[model samples]
Target: MTQKTFLVTGAAGFIGYHTSERLLARGDKVVGLDNLNSYYDVRLKESRLARLQQHENFRFIKCDLADKAGMEQVFRQHQFDVVINLAAQAGVRYSLTNPHAYTDSNVTGFLNVLEGVRHSGVPHLVFASTSSIYGANTKQPFSETQNVDHPLTLYAATKKANEVMAHSYAHLFDFAVTGLRFFTVYGPWGRPDMALFLFTKGILEGKPIDVFNHGDMVRDFTYVDDIVTGVVAAADNPPEGDKNWDGDEPNPATSYAKYRVFNIGNNKPVKLMEFIEAIEESVGKKAIKNLMPIQPGDVPSTCADVSALEKAVGFKPDTSVKVGVENFVRWYREYYRV
Candidate 1:
């Protein structure tokens, strides 16, 4: 493999931090960008940045992706061989309460990323999408070929829109754009808003953990390291225009235009209660359960069909939930000195 410089947006984020660190470890130069928004905990973001700053080849830009001019400047200054965009206003329930945040980050910010890549002559652009796009679809083991037209929340809508936008750009500019639809990713240094973190915190504090959908929910609980693995593989293996693709029978997830989407998940959907049990085992404490109705904009379950990703990358995410939860709990205890 050739050594190259990568521009990774959302470097302070869970997946982004791990991706950047992995690249740095391999002797590649990384330019990381993050606004460090207080969506969850700024302290956690700062801690992620602190570790990346220790690497001599890593440089960080304190800016939001919505700042079009600033984004363009970053692109102009660095000739990034690959651009991985993970920055977005994330969270499903948060999208219901604060819809504008999703618009600002997922929509406007993503546009800025597209603009930067468009003008900067970046070869391959890999960005994050989510499984939430499979909204209201009761299908098991969701595939990339499925229609993702009906989105339940603004966040999912924006991500689906991004897929369309990326396809258009690829067709017009010959740019390679690959979108990875991630599942419920969790691990060490994970986001505080995610289920694993929330459960751990609640259990540790003797508080009741809300079991949504009356414990009927399931998730393809992917490990963060596993997420990073798929992301790096996608960036390295950019898709070429599908010459065999015909407009007569259009495929939503692939195009004749150098664009494609893949599901980066564990391909295993675990029940919510089972996930809670894993957390309990990790902490050696049982949770006070508060069974509740499913929140608006939340899906009952998500399972990924990762055959496309496996074929393209020659790897798959195989981390078991038990090992994953154990890793996370260890980190949480060390980080918080609990």
Candidate 2:
């Protein structure tokens, strides 16, 4: 593969940090951008950015995705071979209460990113989508071709918006744009609001952890490293215009233009209890569970059909839950000195 300069949005974020590191490791120039919002703990984001700063090929810029002028200026100054956008306001349950935040970051911020790519003439743009867009579709294993018209939460709606928005740009600007619907990703330096992080913290602190839906939920929990690998592979192989795409019976995953969507997931759904058990085994302690009804803006199950991803990128996420949880627990212990 040829080396090139890449622009990574949300470089201080969990997935963004990992993605930028992978690009730099492969002898690519990386310019990382982030707003460093206090949505979670800013300290955690800072720590992740600190590690990336150590890389000679990595450069950091503190900028919000919603800042139109700043975004345009950056694009004008730097010529990016590919734009990997991983920044957004993330959180499903939180969106229920703070709905405006979702639109501000996911919608407005995303528009800024699209405009930057458009004006800069970036050939390929790979962005982060979510499996939550499956919404009310009661399919066993969600595929990219499934209808995602019914989104259960504001966060899901915003992500679905991004997919369509990018598709339009791909058609009009004639740029190769790919959207990745990432499943439940967890690993070292993971987000604090994610299930594994909360569960591990509660168990270690001897506090009762809330088990929603009476522990009936199932998820395709993907490891972060595996997700990063899949992301890099997708970035390297931008989607070309599908010559065989039929307009009469359209496929939601791909268009006649240089646009496509793929799911990057573990493919194996793990029960809520089974996932908790893995964390328990890693921590050597049982969690104090408070079983409760399912909260609003949440689903009971989610699985991914990553066949399209494999066909396009020649790779799929295969990390087991046991191994992923162990890695997180080990990292958590060291990071917090638990």
**Per-residue lDDT of candidate 1, residues 1-338 (tens digit):** 67899999999999999999999998899999999999988999999999999999999999988888888889888999999999999999898889888888888999989988999899999999999999988877899989898999999999998988888888888999999999999999999999999999999999998888999998999998889988998999999888788788888778888899999999989998999999999999999999999898888889998998999897578789999999999999999999
Please provide, for model 2 over 169-276, each residue's C-alpha lDDT reduced to its tens digit, 9 standing for 90 to 100: 999999999999999999999999999999999999999999999999999999999999999999999998989999999999999999999999989999999999
Candidate 2 TM-score to native = 0.99
Compute each candidate's TM-score over C-alphas. 0.99, 0.99
TM-score, model 1 to reference: 0.99
Report how far residue 263 has shifted in candidate 2, in Å. Answer: 0.7
Error of 2 at 240 (Å): 0.7
Worst 10 residues of 2 by lDDT: 311-320
Question: What do the candidate models score in CA lDDT, each in turn?
Answer: 0.92, 0.94
Off by over 4 Å in 2: none
* Model number with the top lDDT: 2
